[model samples]
Target: MIPWIELDSAAIPGETGTLRLKRRGDEFSIMLGANELMNSRLSGSEEALAELSCAKLAGRKAPVVLIGGLGMGFTLRAALAVLPGDARVVVAELVPAVVKWARGEMAAVFKGSLDDPRVEIHTGDVASLIEKSKSAFDAILLDVDNGPDGLTRASNDRLYDAGGLGRSGRALRLGGVLAVWSSGPDPRFTARMEKAGFATEVRTVRANAKRRGAKHVIWLGVGHR
Candidate 1:
């Protein structure tokens, strides 16, 4: 049987230890503590997020999209696939190591998203970017932390909180959408979105199955900023 091999490592601010990237053959996994943040085989939730978020920006000018995390660049690649030539993507990733892994070791997995002209990588907390931008994005896809219930970073809770959602609402242009990827469902987060005045929809998608099985949830929280 093949075993997981340590391929790369990087540090995230506020994390107790370094984030490790491991590989078993062609597949890869991201590890923080004992948890597997994500794997290469099944990025359905991320793809779903990019798809739904981009749907909201159809026909918008320049169509600026903000992606809160760049995990393997699946979401970004998916977004770039559907977005028009004039569209632009701003990705905020908190961990510099993660960025390095994506640019260096994980480059093949990312499929050249880093070199795309429309991409702008910001190495910082996504919240700060949200707070600083003024109605900038047509879509905000947040894959940082594990949805509303964060596991890797305690500070990520703010991104799922009402106050954070409010800031995200303010960061988008009118009729923009906020899509959040979750390993599981959170009703309270949905309620928070409702309270923040978004027309929300919960989408369940499978990692590989097209018909539906072993599904993951993506909360599509649509709002008019």
Candidate 2:
């Protein structure tokens, strides 16, 4: 077995703990204390977060998408693969260290997705962007923290609350998609989405593409027109 090596560690902005970047051979992981926030090898659900949401905008021209987290760049890369050439993708990452890890130690994991012509990196809170915009995105994909029951920061809880769901709905265009990736299910989250005027579907997906990993949840909500 290959030994895991700590590449670097960085404080998670306002969080008390720091994120540790570890590498084992070709694999990489981002850990917040004991909780593994993301892993390069387990990206099935994260990819689905973008795939499921982008599927909702099949006919829209130059659709704009906002991705709330850039963990391992799985969602962003997946979105770029299926979205039209003219479409734009804005990725908001709260921790600057995560961005540095993408460009530095984990560049291969990202595969140049950061430099894609249609993508932009916002080094700030995704919530702020959601609050400042109205009907600004065709799809809003969130893979922040550990879903509704967060781990990294208490503030992340806001992104799953009723008020946050309302903000997400307002940020999206009518009939647009709001896709959220979670480590597990939260029935209350589904209810919140529905109350926020979105027709919602809860899906359980395997973490790995081989379909042999932990069951992760993805909430696909289409904003009511």
Candidate 3:
């Protein structure tokens, strides 16, 4: 078995912990402290995030989507696959190094999703975008941190709170959807979405496409029409 090799490291802004990129042959992993945030080999839930969200906006013309976190670009790629050619995807990644890693070492993993004409990369907080934009996006896919609990950065907690959910709802068009990816389940988060006027549904998906890995959760919150 090939040992994991640390390719590079980057500090998480506003947090003491660092994100380390490691590779074991063709497989890649991104770790924050002791927690493995994402892996190239396990992207089923990430892809599902985009697929499920886009499903809600299927008939919308040139839908605008906001993706919170680039990760390995699984969500972005999946979104581009299902969305129409004119649909726009805005990806907000807080960590600049993560974006660099995606374009550099993890380029192959991303498979040129960054170069897509319809995709835009924002190296800033997704919350800011949500707060500023009113009824702008047709779908918002959030894969930031571990879940609503915030494992990478404490500030990410606001994105899952009631206020944040309100901002997200306001930022979305009528009948828009907010899809969130989590390492595990959080009933409280679902309730918070409901309180913010979103019809929510939680789905459990396999980490791997083969359906052999641990189950991850995705919450689909549909905005009021």
Instruction: Report the number of clashing residue pairs per model.
Output: 0, 0, 0
Error of 2 at 102 (Å): 0.8
Runs of candidate 1 with Cα error greater than 4 angstroms are: 209-213
Q: Model 3 over residues 95-141: C-alpha lDDT tens digits?
A: 99999998899999988889999999999988888899999999999
TM-score of 1: 0.95
lDDT for residue 62 in candidate 2, whole number 0-100: 96
Which pairs in model 3 have colliding backbones? none
Error of 2 at 24 (Å): 0.7
Give, for candidate 2, the lowest lDDT window spanning 10 residues: 145-154
Flag clash pairs in model 1: none
**Which residue pairs overlap in candidate 2's backbone?**
none
Q: How accurate is candidate 2 locally (lDDT)?
A: 0.91
Query: lDDT of model 2 at residue 198?
Result: 87
**Candidate 2: residue 45 lDDT (0-100):** 86
lDDT computed for candidate 1: 0.86
Local distance difference test, candidate 3: 0.91
lDDT of 2 at 162: 88
Ranking by lDDT: 3, 2, 1
